[model samples]
Structures are given as structure tokens and as C-alpha cells.
Target chain A: MEKVMAFTGDEIAAEAMRQINPDVLAAYPITPQTETVQKFSEFVAEGRVSTDMIRVESEHSAMSACVGAAAAGARAMTATSANGLALMWEIIYIAASYRLPIVMPVVNRALSGPINIHCDHSDSMGARDSGWIQLYSENCQEVYDNLIQALPIGEDRNVLLPVMVCFDGFIISHGTEGVAVLEDKVARNFIGEFKNIHSLLDIDNPVTYGPLDLFDYYFEHKRQQVEAMEKAPEVVKKVGKQFGELTGRFYGLLEDYHLQDADLVVIAAGSTAGTVKATVDELREEGVRAGLLKIRTFRPFPQKEIIQKLSKAKAVAVMDRSASFGAIGGPIFLEVRSALFEEQKKPLVISYIYGLGGRDTGINQIKQVYHDLAKAAQSGKVSQLVNYLGVRE
Target chain B: MKLKGWKDIPWGGLILEAGNAQKYETGGWRTFRPIWHEDKCKQCLFCWIYCPDGSVIVEDKKVKGFYYEHCKGCGICAQECPFEAITMEEESKFRKDQGGRP
Candidate 1:
């Protein structure tokens, strides 16, 4: 029987991992992400799940172990946040290169300097092009749903790639919300059995993995990875449909909210989308035409769908919690602008960088954005292409 | 074997054919080639024991000519031959088929 439980994003992620019962889980703990692996470890100790829990020394070793286990034909998984994700950067690429379907839950946190352990997009955005499917969650429920769906999306024959499920640190990761938890049997049946390809442990037909490709074949292999990423969206769609059939919650590359007919639109991902959604409703009730495009899948970045969604709007605002430094706006903003470049008539798009290092982004700020949009819509121009939110000027 | 294109090659650069690395003639890297003298004294089999790459051909408890295909010309066998039965010769001296010196 399906039941609703009040769970923090971290706790829900642990619950989902427990349901999947990955053959091996190799992880190093970091804050926000720590409670997840900690709770899963308790499950391991209690004999609730039969997963081989590898307590790796660091995030690098954690990913390395997951890569090894996955290559050896075990269903492998890991969870990390912030500096831990940064440390695993190198092997994260290797795991994708090897076409290993390891699903990792990354509790989004700021990259360090004047160190702060708070929520931001910098960590995952830094790894946007590392050849893994990235899923962004707006709430604890999406966090659970995304994690449950990751295995099938990645293990598809045409899309043998790793996946990273990202949610805001402290915001979603620490905050508790009501999530409808699927029964263990239903969850198991949804994922089905694991079928690996060209595993290292297939002793009958010996194979060599991670071979020295050199100039002769390295480019060709990279092309193969590109093809895999190209094939991922359709597979993600199919899996999402199947998951929705089992449960009642459907998923897609991006969540369309009040976007059908609107002059002003806001494109945002992660927990901030919920804020945008609430603010969009408020604007609509107050007789303002406002809508939101909540990004769910950020990697196989839904370019065509995004263009169709925002093409007719007078103006669009992309909310990025991470700074891009030298680039024009942040990561999502750059992509949205680039996607619009293909349209003959497109929205006047701008960037709003907000919520870095766990800064509070409230309803008033979102409302202020719509007010700015009202002015920009009438004036046919934006004063600034890039604006920082929840920060003093 | 023919070289493969991007689409023709296996995904992830996997080598499905196991132990096929032997086909690549690494002896091409050799600068000095070893000449084994069968007429000279002892067949102590020490060369067979010391040859790196298993290039020393062993038949019925006796040493035969070097395989030459895999020999890296390390001269470890020549150094181990107490009877001075092996000689290291300059590789570029011979033709491609080991005929007369160029």
C-alpha cells in the first residue's frame, strides 16, 4: 500500500535508496548529504537492506569504488554534497566514460573558498558537461521520484550513462515535507531486475575496460558518449511514463506551470521553482499574466521543449543560484539564451542569480521580479541583462 | 586487422577480443637484435629462463631460435649466456627479411 510520510529531502533519498536496494553503495558523507548516507548506513546495520555499504575515505574514493562496482556488474550508488562532489569530479567523468549506470544524489551546496555549507547550484553546475544525466528536484517528493527513476533512465541500452539527482542543500535536504512513499514490492517491481552490459565480471567472455584509446579511437569513443546522451531524453520520457503508471505522479524534462498563455515567464530549477510557482499564482490572481518554467532535467537540457515554452512570452527571467564568473549570466541563463537564438521571434530573456551560500529568497523578491517584468514588458527593453537577487547592491 | 571508424568501434573503447595484444609486433621497437649460436657449447637453457617477453623458443627441453616477433632485443639472454653463444647485432644492418646487410 502507498502511504504518505513527512520526510526531509535527505531522509526521502535514503528511503528511495533503501527501496531500490542497490547491490553496492560506496559513499563518503558531507553535510546535507551526510544524513542520507547516515540513515542508509543504519538500514545496512539493521539488516533492512542487503546492500554492501562501502565506507570510503573521501568522495574521490567513494566514486572510484562505485565505478569499480558498476563496471563489475553490480548495481552501484553513492550520495554526496559540496566539497565532496568537487573531490569526486575526476572519477565522475570516468564513470560516465565507462557507461556505468551509477545514480548519485547530490545535495546542492556552494563550492568553498571562504567556506560556507549552504545551498547553491555551483557544485552541480560546475559538472554540467561531465556526461551524466542531471535531474533537479523542486521538493522532497520530486527528490524521491527522481531517485527512483534514475536507474531505468541510465541503464537503457541506448543511454548507458550515469545520473546525478540534485536538490537544494538545507532547503530541500533539511526541510521535511509530506511524500507519498511507494510500497517496497511496488518499488522493486518498478525497477525490475538489473541487466548489465559488458561487465568486468563476465568471466566467460573476457573484456578489457578503460583501455588506452590514444588519438586513434578516443574521438570515436567520445562520439559514442555523445550519442548516448542524445538518446537519453526519450528514454527518460518512457521511464517517467512507466513510473507514473505505477504511482500517480508523472514527470518530464521540465515542469510546465501556468505557461500556456502568459506575457511574463520565470525559468528556474530546484527548490526555488516552488517559490516561483507560488509567486506566479499570486501574480495571476492579482490580474497579472505570469507563468513559470520549472526545469526538472538540466543535463540533456530540453532545448526544444524550453524554446516552445518560452518562445511566445514577451520576457523571460532565468533564476540561477550559481555565478558564472566570466560568462554572460549563469549556466541555465546562458543555455536559455542560446536556445532562444534559434527562434525567429523569441522572448526578451534576462538572468537573476540568487540564493548563493544558503541566502533566503522570499516571496517578496519573486514578486519584485514580476514587477520588473511588468516594466520591461512595456518598455521593450531590460536595463540590465544580469541581476543579483537577495543580495545588497 | 583493419582500423575501425567511430561508429564501427565498440562503445566505451572495450576490447572484446581478449589477449590479442600479441598481434602488434613490438619487435619493431628493437635497436639491437640478438643472434643465437647453436654450434657453440652449452644449451644451459639460461637464455630461455632470462628472455623477457618469452621470445626464446623452447622445444623438448632444448632452446631453439628466437621468435623475433615479440623480442624487444633487451640482450638479457646474451648477458646470461656464460658460454658466449649469443651476440647482439645492430638491427638496421639487415634487410627487412634478415637477408644481406644493407
Candidate 2:
């Protein structure tokens, strides 16, 4: 039987970690993400889980240790946020290149220049091309669910890649919410035991990892990574279905809310999806045909599904919590536009950069975005293709 | 072995062997070869200790001969020999006397 409990996103993520109880956990403390490791440490102290918690000196070493552990045929996991993720950038690529099947929970925070630690997508968005499967969560429940699903997806023989489960920094990480957690035996049974095809510890069959390929084979190795990424969606769906059967909560690449007959839709990710859904409900009550498409898996982006759903709308607004400076719009917007380019009948797609540096995205501000989308639907022209929401001009 | 294609290579370009230096034949790269004098009045083994590649063959604590298959003919052994027990000979000259070596 499942247990219902209230936990902050970080605490729930730690709960999921406790349930999975990976072989190794190498992590460093960074705000928002720190509590996850802290809570997991308490689990270790209480002797609840036998995870070999490695207190690494820095985020770089943390990820490096995870890489070493995973490569040595252990199921390894870690947690980080913002600059800690940035510090692990080099090894992040290495982890994927080696296909380590390590899972990490990333608390989404603003990357520094002004050095502010707050809710934003800049951290994970910056690593969109780092070759890891990225799963975004709307709240604590989803964070727990995503973490549970991440293991099977990444550890799938066909996928064999690292997974990043991201959620808004303070919004979800600090905010407490009710969640349904699976029993340890059932969760373990669902995840099963990790079986690495090639490991450094395989004594009989010796295999090499991270070799130097000048030009003779580098392209093909990269192509293999590409092929693995292409195979992820199917594996993700299958794993999600199995998890849903166990927990009674289904998941998909993207979540569609009231998009069936709506004329206008808003596309966003992470905790902002909850905000958009609320605004959509309020707008629907006012006789406005508003809908939402919340992206769950951002790495193997649900491009076809996004195009199919958004194609029915007369206008679409993509809200990005992170900015892509010097580009036409934010990362999510760019992907949404590119996905729509192949459609025979395209919607009036616009972008809104919002909620940067932990700025509040009130229901009123979200309603204003819906109003703008409705106006664009009526006029059939997007006067402003890209705009900033709630920013002091 | 020949690498047929990129697919033949392992992911992340890992070389698993502890020392694969033997797979590469360094002898062909030599412009000069080191020739050892059997009776140089001393067997100090300085050349064996200083050799970058473990090409120097030592038997019963005595300088035996060079494993020419792996030696690059860098002349380091000839230069490091304390009693001038080794000399660097031009490859062309050494080729003519190759029959004299075991």
C-alpha cells in the first residue's frame, strides 16, 4: 500500500532516494539542493539506508566520484543546484559520454553573475545539450515521481544514460506539499537491480572506458550517444507506464490540460506549470478557451506531441523561466517555434521570458499572458513576438 | 588488429590495457640505433635505469641487450652509459651489421 505524507520537494526527493537506496551517493552542499543531501545524510545516520555517502570536496569531485562509482558498476546518485551544477559541467559531459546511468536531482536556481540564489530554469536550461535526459517537475509529488521513474529510464540497456530530475529551487524544494509514496519493497521491485553491460570491475571480460579517439572513431561514438537519446522516449514511456501501474499516477512526455478544444494555449515547464494551470482554470471559468501544455521531459523534447497539441490553437505563448540572451527568445520558445515550423497550419507563436531570479509570477500576471494570447488569436498577428513578463522596464 | 569502423571502438575512448606500448613497433622510427659493447669494463646499468621505454633487457644483474622491437633509438642509453659501453650508430650502418646480433 502507498503512504501519504507531506514533505518539501527536497525532503520528498530524499525520501525517494531513501527508497531507492542507491549503492553510492557522492554530493556537495549547495542551497536548495543542500537539504536533499542533508535529509539523506540523516537517513544514513539512522542506519535506515546503507548508501555509501561520499562527502566530496566540491561539486566537480562529487560528480567525478559518481562517475567513478557508476563506471565501476555501482548504481550511483547525487544532488546539486545552480553553480554546483555549473561546477560539474566537465564531468557531466563525461558521465554521459561514458553512459554511466547516474541519476541526479537538480534544484533549479539562477546561475550567477549577480550571484543570486533563487528559483529559475537557467541552471538546467544551460545544460540542455549536455547529453543527459532532463525531467522537470511541477511540485513535490512530481519531483518524487520523476526521481522514481528516472532510474529505470536511464538504466535501460537501450538508453544507458544519466538522468537529471529538476524542480524549481525554493518554490518546490522549500515548499511542503502532500505526496503519495510507494512502499520500499514495491519501489525496489519496480526499479529492480542495476546490471551494467560493461564495467571496470568485470574481471573476466576487460573493457576500456574514456579512450582517446583522434578522428578514426569519435564521430561514431557520438552517433551512438545520439541513438541512445533517440531510444529514450520509448523507454521513458514504458517505465512511466510501469511506475503508474504501481503507484496509480501516470506520466507522459508532456501533460496536456484542457487543450482539446481551446483556441489559445500556454506552454511552460517546472513549477510554473502549476501556476499556468490555475490561470487557465480561472480563464476557462470566464468563458475563455485557454489551455496549457506542461513539458515533463525536456531533453528528448516531446516535439511531435507539442506540435500536434499546439497546432489546434489559434495562438500559443511559450513562457520561459530562463533567457537566451542575443537570441530571438528563450530556450523553450526556440524549441516550440522550431517544432511548429513543419506544421502545415501554424499558430501565432510568441515567447514570454518570466520569473527570473526567483521573481513572483502571480495569477494576475499569468492571466495577462492569457489575455495577450487571446488578443493575438483575435488579431491573427503577434505584434510583439518576444516580450518580458513582470520585469521592471 | 585493424579498427574496421567507428563502431568497433568503445564508447568514451577508453584504453583498458595497463601498458599497450608493445602494440606499437617503435624500431622503425629510429634514425640512429644504440650498439652495446660487450666488454666495456663495467656493467653499471645506468642505461637500464634511465630508459624511458623499458627496452633495455637486463639478465642476472648484467646488461644483456636491447629489445629493438620497442626501442625508438633515442640514443639516451648511449649518452647515459658511464663507461661509454654503448654507442649510437647510423641506421644504415647498423642495418649492414644486423646479421651480427642475435
Candidate 3:
């Protein structure tokens, strides 16, 4: 059974955690992510879940406790936003290197200097190379779905690495949306029991974990992690397929919105993808061959699928919500532009840095991108390699 | 033993087999090996308790010999021994034929 519940992105994420009912959940509260931890704590207080909720001192310990629990062969999860994620930096890599299969829901907030609490891609982007599988969510619905799917995806024997399911802080995190939540029993069955192969607590086996690996072995161990990362896309596809069957919504590494006949395509991730989708629909109604390629999985980047979906377009605009300092484009734009490099019939690609520090990326701005794409296509070239949207000059 | 390729190893350097540390002989890392003076020995087993690598050999509650295959020759047993029953010796002084306790 499925029920559509009105929940903010944070609330739906907590609702998913409640249903997962993991053996351990350790998290520290930070803006945009605090409500998720608070809601899960409410579940603990109400006896809704059997999870050992560790109200930790900081995000660092929260991630460390999760690493310990997961290494001990228990299902573990945690949630955090910008600065909190920054604090979990060292352990975040350890979780993946140790292959602990810890699941984390990261609310994407702008990293601080002159600090402000709001949505951006800086938090998760900073950990882009931390060896965790990254799933970017467009709205509350994807947040709920991704959190549920992250379990089987990370815990799969072929790909036992940590996973971070990312949704834009406050944009999706605080905004209300009607989300279809799976029945508790159905979700529980899908997640199933965590099958631990090499656990610290598996006393009969008496295994060692995270030992001081030196030059003789450290490189080889790291190579194995890369192999697992290379193997993850298949597991993600399989799990997403299985999840679609359970619920009614299908998912893949990326979503192609009318790309089959599109001459101009816009690429985006997170909440901006939703805005781009709306703009695509409006343009299509007005007889424009506009489309969108929404990135669902950002890490292990799904380059092949991205290339395929974007091949037919005459011009493509890659929108990134975070900036990459001293780079040609933002993170997603860099991947898309690089992926299209070798394609025989590749479209003219351009990059747009938008929505940094929670700025509103309105539908008009998305339409303006389509107009720029059309102009670029007409001129047989993109005037600028990179562009900025929804920001004052 | 040959070093296993990355593909041949476990996913994350997980030591799957218990007591497999015995297969990895760390004794070659030694520069200074320990010499046991059996004549001066009063075997209270302080050396047995103090050996970090469990290299101290004991039999019937008596001091036996060192397991040189696993000892890194840290000399903690010599330092902890109440009496000077054990002493440190440079490995250069010993030839293969004179490499004492197994």
C-alpha cells in the first residue's frame, strides 16, 4: 500500500528513516537538516522505531559513530547540512574506504566564510571525491525515494560503499510537497536484513578492519574501492528498477525530458531541474523543440547515459547550482562538457552557474537559457563558454 | 608467498581468516634481536606478558625460547624482565648457522 503524505523534504527524509528503522542513527542538528534529526528523535520518543538514536556532540562524532556501528555489521545512517558535513570530512572518507555501507541524507547548504544558512551545492560538492555514491534529489519525492533506495544500493555485495542522498537545503528541505511513502512493511521487505561479510563483531571470524595499511598494501586496497565504484552503476540501475516496481515511479541515473526530438536541451540537477522541466513543458506547448536532462546520480557520474540523452540536441546548457573556483564551469557542467567531448554528433555545450547561496532560479530564467541556446544554435556557436543565471551583476 | 593482485584481495583489506597474522612474518623487520640467558633466568613470565607480538615462547609455566618468525625484536621483554635474563643483540653479530632460538 502507498499513501501520499504532505511532507517537507526534511520531513519525508525523516519519514523514510523511520521506516528504515536502522540499528543505529547518529546525527547532529544544523539548519535545514535539524528538523530531520528532530523528527526522527520524535519517532524515538514515541516508540515508532527501534533505532538507537545517538544525540551526538558534533557532526564529526555523528559520522564516526555511524562508521563504528556500520563496521560492527549494523545498519547505520545519519543526516547533516553544510558546516556539519564539513566537520564529518575525515570520517566520511573512512566510511567509504572501510566499505561500511553507511547511508547519509545530506541537505545541501552553502559552505561558510561569511556564513548564511540556505540552499546550495557547496556541501555535497566539497565531498565529491570522498568515494561515496551521490544521488541528487529534485524535490521532496526524490528525497523520500532516494533515501529508501540508498540502503540496497550501498549494501549490495558488489558495491559496499557509503551513499549520500542529496536534496537542496531549505528549497526542498523546508518546502512542502505531497510525497508517496511506501508502507512500512513494504519498505522493510525491500531493505531486508543487512548481510555483513567482514564484520568486527563477527567474533567467530575474528576479522580486522581499518588496520594501518602501509605502502605495501594501501594502494591495492584503494584500487579495490575504485573497482567497487565502477561496479556501482549497475546496482543503482537494478535497485531503481526494483524500487519502481514496488512503487509506481520509475527512476534512472538521469531523466530525459522530451530529448528524443529536442534541438535545444538544458541540463540541471536538484530543484533547478524541476524549474527546467516546467520551462521545457511551456516551450514544448509553444512548438519549441526544448528538452531537459535532469541528473539523478551525480557521482560515478553516469557519463554514458548523459551522452546518449544529450546527443541529438543542437545546443545544450548545463546548469550547476554550485561554482567551481578557477574551473571552466561548475561541477555538473564540467562532467557534461567532458562526457560529450568524443561524441561524433555532439551538441554545442555551454555552462551556467546559478542558484548559489539559495538565490531563486525562476521559470523565466530557465526560459532565458532556452532562448540563449536557440541563439547559440542559430549562430552555430555558443558566445560564452560559461554563463551565470539568477544573480545580480 | 607472492603478493596478491588488487583483484585477488578482499574488498577493503578485510582479514577474513582468523589467526592469519601468523602467516605474515614480521620478524624480518628486526635490527636488534633478543638473546635469552637461560642460566640467569627466573621464569616469572614477565617477558611472556610483555612481548607485544606474542613472540615469547613458554612451556609448562617455564621460559622456553623466542618465536623469531614473528618477533620484530622490539626488546620490550628484555626491558620488562625484573632480572637480566634477556638481553639485546645486533642481528649483524649472528650468522644463519648461529641464529639461535626459533
User: Which 10 residues in a row give candidate 2 chain A its minimum summed lDDT?
Assistant: A208-217
Tens-place lDDT digits, model 3, residues A302-384: 98898888878899999988899999999988888889888889899999999888888899998999999999999998799
Kindly give the number of clashing pairs for every candidate: 0, 7, 0
Candidate 2 true-interface contact recovery: 0.57
- Native-referenced DockQ of model 3: 0.64
Point out where model 3 deviates above 4 Å: B91-102
Q: DockQ, in order, for the candidates?
A: 0.75, 0.40, 0.64
Candidate 2's docking class is acceptable
- Please list the C-alpha lDDT of all candidates, in the order they appear: 0.91, 0.91, 0.91
Runs of candidate 1 exceeding 4 Å displacement: B27-102
lDDT per residue for candidate 2 within A206-291, as digits (tens), equals 77777666566677778888888999999988988887888788898999899999899999999989998999899899999999
Q: For residues A1-393, what per-residue lDDT tens digits would candidate 1 score against the true structure?
A: 689999999999999999999999999989879999999999999999999999889999999999999989999999999899999999999999989999999999999977999999999999998999999999999999999999889988899999999999999999999999999998888887877778889999788888777877899899999999889989989999998888878888988889999899999999999999899888889989999999999989999899888867998989999999999998999999998897789888989999999999988999988888888899999988999998997
Which one is best on TM-score? 3
Query: What order do you get sorting by TM-score, best first?
Result: 3, 1, 2
TM-scores for the candidates: 0.93, 0.90, 0.94
